[model samples]
Target: MVQNLTKRASPHNVNDRKEVLSGSCIEATASEIIQESNENMTVADAVAQMFENLGVKSAYGVSGGAMASLWGALSNSDIDVLNFRHEAGAAFAATEGYFASGNPTVVFTTAGPGITNALTGLFAARGEGAKVILLSACTSAPQRGRWAIQETSTDTLPSSGIFTTGTVFNYASTVESAAQLPQIFRKLAVGMSQPGGYVAHLTIPTAVQNMLMDETQLPEQGVSCSLVTADAQVVGNVAKLLRSGTFAIWLGFGARGAASEIRQLAEKTGAAVMCSPRGKGIFPENHPQFIGVTGLGGHGSVMTYMQEQAPVRTLVLGSRLSEPTSFWNQEMVPSEGFIHVDVDANVPGVAYPHAETIGIVSDVKAFVLQLLDILEAEEISESQLKASQPSSLPKPERSPVEAGSESLIRPEILMEAIQKVIVDGTDAVVMAECGNSFTWSTNLLRFSQANRYRVSTGVGAMGHAVTGVVGAAQARDGIAVAIVGDGAMLMNNEISTAVKYQIPAIWIVLNDARYNMCHQGMKMLGMTGADAIIPETNFEMIARGMGAKGIRVTKESEITAALETAIAANGPIIIDVLIDPDRPAPSKGRNKGLASQGVKSTSEQKPKVQASFPNI
Candidate 1:
């Protein structure tokens, strides 16, 4: 589907094609070739060509009149432009799509409300570390300060974070002329080539988008960059440090690509491995050395390991060890501080400022490879390290919950079925939405590989996974199941979008009829008079009304059959499980953190504790 202008030989478009030779045709750019072929090409077309060259395969957005030309250009290009229900949903989908596809995805919006609506999802993208570009339209220069319709001028909106390079956007620019196209494209290309997540913004005015571009003005088609790598001496020092004392591996989502090397490193050092919630699948969760996840619905075994058989120093891999992961827990700190390796140099010591940290700015995979080389060169075998390590590391507790004769299903039983039918049986990507859904899934399901389990611990947006599953399914070209609560399912579900695209995205809604996390969390903190209840909703009916399949599950025994059916369905499906409202999710740590932060708690009312199992 790559449209080559040089090869277009149709009679009607014959005038559009021309041959241009520059200095014996030795160094002519693709843009120059295109300029020679199509003299009447607009700025939109030029930008589209640049996106094609830059490896952007898809764009998600809600189309508007302002961006009509740009939309047309993208539609004509190889990039798949998906018209979503809402701008925020589109942005969320784009975020997940970027992660699933490993490509810089685009989220397009038109003026004012369109631009503002997508900000939350864009923030999520920035926090989760994904490459997403927001292509929007702004008020034309002549129309600025005037009473223009949906005027997206500086007078109307704050330009600091949205239109400038700062926390939100890695790069931002307004294309005022066709001449800026090349430089803009170059910046985008260069930015996308760098490590870690990059969220950018490019707003083109309506007038400029349709303006005829000159032959000399076209987007640049070439840009290249290299991955960050640690210095040889630094790698050697890290290896020596690891060899000198006991160290545990603390993983974050950033270390996802280094799973193989991480496994080797863990086995070689006989280190107990723990992960953040987002880092679920990066290391094999079922491995003997694996302790458990770290924060927010994290396992108690990790605390036990840190308390009882504390390592001399912890090897932090690509994680900031932020509040969500560690809650700044003092016990998790090692005796000799941490050797934190991350792509971002600033991430290491920022979370726990008091803790001594040796930060290495390099790709996790690259750093691990070099460290492995040093260990191998010194002939540091597993047998040598095993004697000093714990004879038995604590593993995550997995309590068995029977399918009791309760009218409403238990969340634990639901997760068990999902683990059996979807997580284990199929190759679907499982995502858990924020709230109790996040806690339940993080505490229950186990993944053995990277990219299989995804959760937004960064921003922890409510409706993210509910709508993002569509993008993941489409980008991955496979089944993507979203474990979401009824609140999220109702707030934002892309069943219609999935139906439009014929994507078989699935949602397992914990239909508890309330914001259960807020409900339970408030109760656990002993706060009163806060209403988190919602009128009971049937997500199955909503899904069916949206032209998708649906199944309602009211009892624990119905979960497996419902999940199996949904997984086998050819189109979008929803499984609405009416979960029990009284069961407390494994969120005691979060409640405890809230209590420490001056939240009120009653001494008489103790929160219901989840049952724990014996260590394996």
Candidate 2:
């Protein structure tokens, strides 16, 4: 029963209600609302129950003095409480959880340094458009402004004033009273219902967390996850624009959920298809309609056609056309205007200028479904539709490794080997980290299903998959494979978390003995650099020491067998493959930026590598 919290709880202290709820240092509301409950429950129980109602399966973070009791409560619940080695790694795991489960996962942190440690992962989550719940505790009310142990300024509570910078989080607030719980959920409902990535920061003082409250007072469902469809007029206009032109389809990570409709649209219109690096698997890279990827690890087939041969208008789907996706090159933009469809209204026409821009604010799946219907209704002729197909374009080629070095395996060979296990053998989740990991996987790996291929390209954070794969593995039935560079693996301690849980995660570490992407870029630019050369460490030995299986692959022949062995193992396995550091870094078209600097190279000498390592 929803009892009035404004009412006093007992005869001895009947005036207690006035002291607590009547302008009593609590965050006030306009009117009286559900403020109290009949059952006795602690603040920790209320918060944990909120997560339960929100369908959270796992909560990741480290236990600290300020938030230990809350972590204790979560441990007794059905949701798994994973104590990560670091707050940032835990937050990254939560971000991956959102991607795998289609629901926001929770990340807990203590006050001060704990909250600050989580900022990088929070930034990556927002950049990737993932939904996550960040819970932290502040110093007790008496400790504020007194330089209490590990106390940060309570004037803002959770942040030092950074969550509001640019687009770090969708919503943030501090809970002052039990009466504000419902209102906080109400705000979360609004943020979750809106399209795009959302991070909600909710901080509670240590004292407020110990307060007694009623369990019935909190709503079971905190977020309104209703299906939002596209506008009929907007989808119809897009269908009309897409039908007649010699246009191509550009796939974004957002289009993964609408794969069937995307294929239907492409078939009906006979359009060419290219995907953003993060969008690889949505349209089936092996399909004839799919030409190549765009950006750092992208191919020249799509870009060359866009520049020299094709009279194409692009149907940009669910992409913001971020700098990496477009390479900030004006030539990639279609001569004719692009018909951009994204759920977020602010995402359209922000990256590249088009001749004409048609913006449609709607969900990717809904828009594709509506567009398919409109295409069938129009009944356009086959020849006209076929005209939209590419005219005798060369198919993408994968050059074989012929460096004749029996010592180090080529990156291409490694990607092909990993692809066999993920695509051919089992239905595993393949994640590519940024840098050469992103480039090799984008260029060499093949994905055909939704949510099968994952990456964080927007923030371009290194070591994302190193920790992010833990949650991804937990959410999936099969194994989660993380292809990471040695440089990225050295960044975090998520391997310990995976080992602790014995989760079926496989880490494919490309041991290049350095930050090969940067090292190669400097050499290619004819400049000397420092600290780019890192000593090769035995990652397999590290995993073994942490209680997980490990394998080291040297020759090309050992690649597939070692991966096979790792897959058949019981727990997390690290396959450290020594890749040829002498191989040119796979840049896709990122080296185009270096052309103006008078760095000329023949096809054989050009370094096909670009640096995309975002700050950790």
Candidate 3:
């Protein structure tokens, strides 16, 4: 009965080849033999088994007819599926998971456009040196060249090779049978275990999904492998340079794994530690050796420190050092000598031209551990290490207010209230929209192990924060809070998605009437006449219309009460805090003068701009 069922579901056409079956070649049809063993398994079963062997915990993607069978397989397997608002959002969540845990994450999308939508996140993972597996379903094999619904050729995507910028050590195509599945999975494991990166794109035909496999012809499990280690001689030479010169360590998103070790190394070497925006929260900002972040949105003091006390050596670990993080200025980084450690060899010398750079291609954690060994061998004294540590900078004092009964809600006070209300055990995920809102969140919020904070690192997309909050809440099964500016809230209709899912995400709208950041920038540049004033809309009403709880707070005292009420409720909630539109957030050295000047006097509040609706 099993053999008959297998025969009926077998592929219609097959080509025969000489094979060592029972140590002899016989005249046999591949289709017949394959069909004979098809009764026990289906395409869905095979895919499930493959994922099981891979030890995948969960997968995220949208569902469609083309991917139904694969989804069924995943459902049957140990992996849980997370449906997302957008395919790209699903991919982004996967990327975040990879960052939090150094494990490769999987994302599956349906055919054609769905697959294309996931490309951005894939590119992000590749650039950040993350191991990610993207599985996309395609139309049935019979639909090739026929313009079937959602039909797309899988070959069009930049080969996993191109995506990795030529650093991918392994790549594989679709598996032909159950026997081939083990080999494909083995290759995937090896690729992920490699120092740099890996991608395996599996395409399945709708017609063959129900076909069974030949158990007798199953292939043996492939070999387990370890990551390629860096050359010891090269490591020793780099160690010598470190010992002889003053050095600084710059941590990027890729160096996430080595956070503790990086901190230790800086403490031991008296080297300063600076991180890129994505690398924020890796180390405690209050640490004595910390020098703050560097780049466009970073502290100006960091730039000053780097320029004045130019370190003779720089130890760059696990960073591609992209244009945005590098400030689009190669001259900012000294050209003298540096050791660039990355999983991918191609990333070390491409972005910046360094005079003497030794590329150590290995896992960030592994490389740091080995380097520690070498440092110990050099007999670096503990007392000397302690003596080299930089003194901690004192925290800046908060600005004092005059003795007046009248009060206004300060940004810092609002942040403190929100932070205080967030319960300790609640697994929270925070998303900060671009602009001063992010500036406030990055500086104020301290994420514990159970929490994660997200932002668009490269593109700096505005609407991503709101959408990301929804997706993240879905992924983590926890409360999500989105801190966004009124400007960003207007750019996207996020309330719609929140309402549709009935997700209990808290939306905190920093309702400043104008594009405050841009306005401040223009005023500082003496372009005061530039159009910076924007008529704000009623965000609370919009939330209410979308079937969410909307509360508006105009007074400073009402902020905490409003937040308490929102946090206690169940579904989506929006708290529009009517902040003093003129207040400026804490600024770096470059913008300190402008911020200190205070908001254009209340009398000069942009001429009381009139619009159809009340702002905030």
What would the per-residue lDDT of candidate 3 be over residues 396-492, giving only the tens digit for each residue? 2234544422355667777777777763335566777777777666555554321256655555555556655654554454577888888877765
Residue-pair clashes per candidate = 0, 3, 0
Best candidate (score: TM-score): 1
Cα RMSD to native, each candidate? 5.4, 8.0, 9.7
RMSD of 2: 8.0
The most accurate candidate by lDDT is: 1
For all predicted structures, in order, the TM-scores are 0.92, 0.88, 0.74
Error of 1 at 253 (Å): 0.5
lDDT of each: 0.84, 0.75, 0.62
Model 3, which residues run further than 4 Å from truth? 1-40, 100-103, 128-130, 154-180, 195-200, 216-225, 328-335, 386-413, 416-429, 434-437, 443-452, 470-480, 485-507, 511-553, 561-616
TM-score preference between candidates 1 and 3, better one: 1
